[model samples]
Target: MIAVLRTPRFLLRQPQLGDAELIARYLNDYDVAGNLARVPYPYHLSDAKAWLRTRVPGLPVEETNFSIELAGEGFAGHVGFHRGPQGPIIGYWLGKPFWGRGIMSEAVEASLDWFFSASAAPVVYSGVFHFNAASLAIQTKLGFTETGRSTLLCLARGAELEHIDTQLTRSVWKARHT
Candidate 1:
């Protein structure tokens, strides 16, 4: 079965058909989409539907995505890993209202613990837009170190931006947690 992870404040559950409206509502905000690479600026209901269709249940750890539902509230955002050519890449986004409350950090930590446990990957990768200080801090706090820099297309901004790439190896994660 696909896993549903729980943190003290949130539940990382699989994205469902019923979640499309909620996902669309939060992602429609430009501020929320601006920081993300793939999310479009005028995110629409159809986009949410397409995204939901892409989520394959029971896929390997690297191929899955999750809905970041608050303990009592509904969908706040999403966190997931995509299998890139080099390795598994982890990514996440939270609604603007949920920012500055350490929610993403908690949600990510819970997912990472599950990811690292389910896969034998030596390192997991993530990247942050140079201006997204909060995202960079989250990765750094979780022990991801700078791997390099790369330019990527930001659909929301309709341009290429330099991203700070970071990686966390199994050993680094273990050291930090233990």
Candidate 2:
């Protein structure tokens, strides 16, 4: 277990095996599956088991996967900051049941704060698909600026021809937090 990252109505923390069932629900949603290249539409229990084995939660928030918890529920969605040699990347998805509720935004803010405060990475980049307005809005709300665009041949869903690159730098994060 890790120290919790608290928001007014949510808690961002390391994930556990118990969260697999709920996380499967979120990953099975096309809205989430389509944008992310790794998720398969028909997410399965085995997939969840493999995910748990990846040990995303046991590592630092800046280097591992984490869960979005909504008070009573243990996990609402998946949100995490992953580190690379260059910097960190943002990856997240909310259960369809929890969409349209501003929950993801709060979770993103909390995660970004954790990343900037804890890691050596100077920035965090998020791959926001052009059609995903909610996700783009979430990035903007967190002060991520439009950096550029990318085209990925997603293994799960073929080519995503309209992916936009968005990023938030340490300087920008510091400016906003101050």
Candidate 3:
């Protein structure tokens, strides 16, 4: 079983097969998918099923997926890290109804705490589409510095778009939170 990380308003739990339906419901929304780089528009139940089947709890934190669940509600979104071209990059998105609630910020902090505690990597990177201001703000508030920019394919947008790359090092993270 995966360990659960709790905050005041949310629980970051390992993604499970049972969550596929709820995951599909939230991800099918254009507003949610558009902000994500990999999620395809018109997301389907099959997509969620396949995605959930891949999440293995015992893996390193960088490869584990967390389903952001509200205290009383079901799945609200997702946050996790994957092996990016340069290093381990974190990524996340919320259901449209849950947007603007600062939930992602909390979820990310909890995830990063777990990640930095478990991994030896000195830095974690995240890239946001130029249009995703809310995400940019969340990363900025988390102490990630702007590293650079590049054009990347947006599966949802169906084109390559300019992305702002940002990174947070272990030393900076420790210093700020100390």
Can you write out model 1's per-residue Cα lDDT over 8-30, one digit (the tens) per residue? 88789999999998888888998
Highest lDDT model number? 1
Q: What is the lDDT of residue 161 in candidate 2?
A: 62
Which regions of candidate 2 are displaced past 4 Å? 56-61
Ranking by TM-score: 1, 3, 2
Q: Which residue pairs in candidate 3 have backbone atoms (N, alpha carbon, C) closer than 3 angstroms, thus clashing?
A: none
Candidate 2, RMSD to the unseen true structure: 1.9
Give per-residue CA lDDT, model 3, range 23-98, as digits (tens): 8999898888887889998899999999987886577667877899897788899998898777899999888889
Error (Å) of candidate 2 at residue 19 is 0.8
Better structure of 1 and 3 per lDDT: 1
- Cα error of candidate 3 at position 169, Å: 0.5
Per-candidate TM-score against the hidden true structure: 0.96, 0.90, 0.96
C-alpha displacement of 96 in model 2, angstroms? Answer: 0.5
As a whole number from 0 to 100, the lDDT of residue 130 in candidate 3 is 96
Worst 10-residue lDDT window for candidate 3 reads: 56-65
Which of candidates 1 and 2 is the stronger one according to TM-score? Answer: 1
**Candidate closer to the true structure by TM-score (higher is better), 2 or 3:** 3
